[model samples]
Target: MGFADELFDLTGKVVLVTGGSKGLGREMAFGAARCGADIVIASRNHDACAEVAREIEAETGRKAMPYSVHIGRWDQLPGLVDAVYERFGRLDVLINNAGMSPLYDSLESVSEKLFDSVMNLNMKGPFRLSVLVGERMAAAGGGSIVNVSSTGSIRPNAGILPYAMAKSALNTMTEGLAKAYGPTVRVNTLMSGPFDTSAHDWEPESLAEGVRPHALQRIGTPSEIIGSVLYLISDASSYTTMATLRVDGGIP
Candidate 1:
């Protein structure tokens, strides 16, 4: 491998990414696979995960396993971890990428179920899974964990107040986990802004308007997120942990 490629190589690593069936999670899974990492792509959609897994293996020659999972349900998480460790025998990287932000008429009108659902999916699930996997990672030597946060965490919008709140907490947990499981395990947050997922039915004009305030003046593409993903999961960020890399296209 060339020097640059060698820096981000994940030849024997096994990575688990929640919400890996589509969008940013899909992109990260492909990036990790391309860098030679075995992948466990988990999401609510089994068929979608399987398709991505096939793509990963065909493009990278790395094993990609698709597992159906609803990350919000706490009861389902233990099995997810067990399945991965049992299959891969080891997990070197974890990306908590599953999230939900439901629209509500007002924060006061948000239903209890909706609020809890957002929190459970975005915060509680990641917390429990990280504790389970991170402890193992520490015992086994070392590993990396990436929490995907949203710009709404800091730039809260009324439409997604609950989701933003959960993400804000996630950002805090990212740093705290780094301290709690550091020296051997690196924990960080990817504070992502907006990205244009082609799968979305969003109109091009509306998408452009949304990116007007960003310094780059354009929404991000999925490929743009891979650099930071690769860096955090590989030796390139050896000295970096407990940090937030805002890949937000400069939301100025």
Candidate 2:
């Protein structure tokens, strides 16, 4: 095979994507499947996960499993991992794509409850999942981890203090895991800008306005994010780790 053709192949790989029911998670799950990876879709919604899994299987002719778990609850992660291992035999990739963004007026206005919820899901959840999966990857000799972050983490947005803070912590966790896991496992964060996904609760008009200043002059679609995700998960990024790949359309 040509170098480029060989580099992106994911045959025989098993990938688990959190928040895989909708939005970018769904897109990434399908992308991995298209590249020849069996996928496990994990989210809090069982029906949604099943639906996405069916779609992936139909489109890619690959095995897709639906798993329901609240990633924010670290206690539930072990069982989820076990389920993946039991079903797939091994896991080769982990995509921490699950997150939440709640609107808060200001830093002071942020409630303790909101802060905890954001941190638990956005930061702590990914960290816990990585740790659990990283062990398996290390034992298997190697794997890849993709953490989903946001531009708000890099360029703080006013009503999103809690969300940004959690994502910021997630970025740091990505770096730390990359180093700690080392030559065995590669870890990276994808700092995303505005992307139109079904998971987002924002209205279309407001979401579009949010990304008008981006270099692309438009918000991204789920398809736009899939290429970057595929690159990170596939052999194309074999030597890459402890990196943050920004897919923000040049937004500062």
Candidate 3:
């Protein structure tokens, strides 16, 4: 194979993507499968995950396993990890892409339940999964872990304060894990900007205002994320680790 083609190839790799049922997670799962990785699609919806898994197998001719579990629930993660290893034999990449940022009226109205839910999914779960998986990856040679974070972590506002806090913690965890699992397993953060996904209710006016601060002056497309995902997961980023690669539209 050509150098560029070989660099991005994932012939025998196994990738597990959380929240793989829809949105950016779905796109990343497809992208990885297309490049020759067997995929594990984990999400809360069993049918939805199965549907995506089927499509991935049909289109890419790669093995795709659908797993259902709530990422926020810490107790459920061990089973998910076991299922992947049992089916795939090994996991070469993990994309912690499942996250939620619920809307609330005001800072005063944000309940402890809401805050804890945000932290559990966005921070706690990812950490537990990484510890479980990263240790194995380190022992079995090496692997890549991409923690999907948001620009809001650094650019926090009252609107997304709790979610932003969680993401910020995720960012810090990525760096720490990189050191803990090195020099074999790679750990990094994929800091994203606003994208036009089902996750957002992007009205025209809101969309326009959202992208105003970006240098690209536009919201990113789901497909546009594939390049960054591929780069981080594949050997293309061999020299990269313990870094936060921003896929944002140059939000400054």
Candidate 4:
């Protein structure tokens, strides 16, 4: 392999990405496959995950396994971890990219159930999955994990307060896991900005206003996240861990 390619090569690595059916997860799965990794794509929707798995297999000639999972359920996570190891025998990379940010009219209208939903999905699930997968990775020699966070974690707004709190906790988890699993496994966070993707539900005028504080003056595109994700998961970042890389267009 060429020197640059050698530095980032992921040949024979098995990557598991949560929420891999679409958006950042889908793109990261494809990117890893392109780098010669076998991938497992998981989401709540079986059909969606299967479709992306099929597409990645067709395009990159890489093995892609798809599983439907609800990250909100703690019991479901162990099986998800088991399924990856059972199918691929090893998992070298994990992208905890699944998340939710439901809208409520106001803070007063927020139900306890709604609050739990956000925390369970965004924070609790990731912690449980990471611990299980990270132990395996550390035992097997080494691995990398990239937890996807949000700019909202640092800049909470009324509409997504619960989501922000969950993401903030996720960031803290990233640091704790890095320390706990290090010397063999690395853990990091990708604090992302607003993006123009299938996940977006913003009007053009609203999006334009939202971009004003960002130095880039535009929403990120899904493909834009691939480089950082690849760097973190591959040998390119062999010495880096417990870091939060900002892909947020420098929002003020």
Candidate 5:
């Protein structure tokens, strides 16, 4: 391998990615495998996860496991962690990327259930999984944790209030975890801006208008997320921790 390639190499490393079935999570999972890591793709949809797993294995010649569980369900997280260790022996990287923001017409329209759902999935679940895996990672030597946050956190609008709040808390969690398990384990936030994911069904005209305010005047493609993710998880970022790296198409 070349000097630059050695820095980003993931040979023999294992990675666990929540929401790895599709969108940016899927892209990251594939990216990691291309760098030589075995992957565990966890998501609510077993079939979706399985498909992605198969594709990753076929394309990258790396081991890929598909596990299904709702990220919002706190009780289910431990089993997921156990299964990964049983399968891969060690987890070198974890990307807390599962999240949702259901549409609500008004602030008053947001119910307790809806708010709780958002919080549980976006913040609560990641915290539990991080503590569980991070402790193990520290004990086993070291690992890296990447919390997939949002530009929404820093640029909160009424439409995405609940999600923004949860991501804001996630940012704080990333910093605290870095300190808690550092000198060994690294923790950081991948703060993302608007991207064209399967989540949106935008026509060209609307898509162009949506990104007008961004400095780049364009939405990011899912593949654009790979470089930043690779940096955080690999040896390339050995001295970095508790940092929020933005790959947000210069969103302003």
Candidate 6:
């Protein structure tokens, strides 16, 4: 097979994408489906997940199933894994894309509840889910994991200290996991810049204003992130692990 043919083809592989109902999650799920991987989308919204799954199936003619679970519970992850195995038989890739960043005042004003909520969802949830999936991947010989981190983790953004801290920890965990599960289960993180997603639901104007400084000079689309996701999951990145790929539109 040609280099391009062998590197990008995902035929017969199964991928599980958390938070795959909307935004970047939905886009990546569709992208994987297009690349010939059967997809299992896990999110808290069943209706939204079903809608996206139907759309992927229509567009790519690949199998897509939606499972609703709150990963932060940790307890809920096993059931979600079981559901994926039940539906897809085996998982070859995992995209820990689901995340939350609730608005908070300042670091001095940050509440314990808010801090824990952000850390639990953004950091702890992905770690727990990875453990569950990594074990299966190891037993099956090999697999790939892509954690969706944020640029805020490296470059702090005011008023969201907890979110940044959790993402920073997640980035660290990505490197740790890659080493711990090395030579079998490849793990990496994508440190993304500002993107226009559900943030519009909170601060529409600020969301629009936040994209001005990037090299792209515009907000990124969910489709833009899918390229990096595809590379990490496919054999194109066979030699890459313990790395953080930035898709941040040149945000320094």
Top candidate (lDDT) = 5
Ranking by lDDT: 5, 3, 4, 1, 2, 6
**Each model's TM-score?**
0.96, 0.94, 0.99, 0.98, 0.98, 0.93
Give, for candidate 2, the lowest lDDT window spanning 10 residues: 195-204
- Estimate the lDDT of model 4: 0.94
Q: Kindly list the per-residue Cα lDDT of model 4 for residues 1-252, writing each as its tens digit.
A: 899788889999999999999998999999999999999999999999999999999999999999999998999999999988889899999899999888899999999999999999999999999999999999998999999999999999998999999999999999999999998999999999988788778798988897987899998899999999999999999999999999999999
The alpha-carbon RMSD values of the candidates against the true structure, listed in the order shown, are 1.3, 1.7, 0.7, 0.8, 0.9, 2.0
What tens digits encode model 3's per-residue C-alpha lDDT throughout 11-100? 999999999989999999999998999999999999999999999999999999999999999999999999999998999999999999
Off by over 4 Å in 2: 1-3, 201-212
Clashes of each: 0, 0, 0, 0, 0, 0
Model 6 has a clash total of: 0
Tens-digit lDDT string for candidate 5 (93-133): 99999999889999999999999999999999999999999
Model 1 residue pairs with clashes: none
How many angstroms is residue 7 displaced in model 4 relative to the true structure, after the best TM-score fit?
Answer: 1.6
lDDT of 6 by residue, 1-252 (tens): 677767888999999999899989888998899889999988899999999989999989999998889878788999999988988789999999988887766778888888887888899999999999998998899999999999889998786678889999999999989987888999999888877687545365775576666777676877898889999999999999988999988885
The TM-score measured for candidate 3 stands at 0.99
* lDDT per residue as tens, model 1, 1-252: 899899999999999999999999999999999888999999999999999999999999999999999998888999999999999899999999999786678878998999999999999999999988999999999999999999889998888789899999999999889998988999999999888774455687888898888999987888899998898899999999999999999997
Task: Give residue 18's error in model 3 in angstroms.
Answer: 0.2
Candidate 1 C-alpha error for residue 8, in Å: 0.3
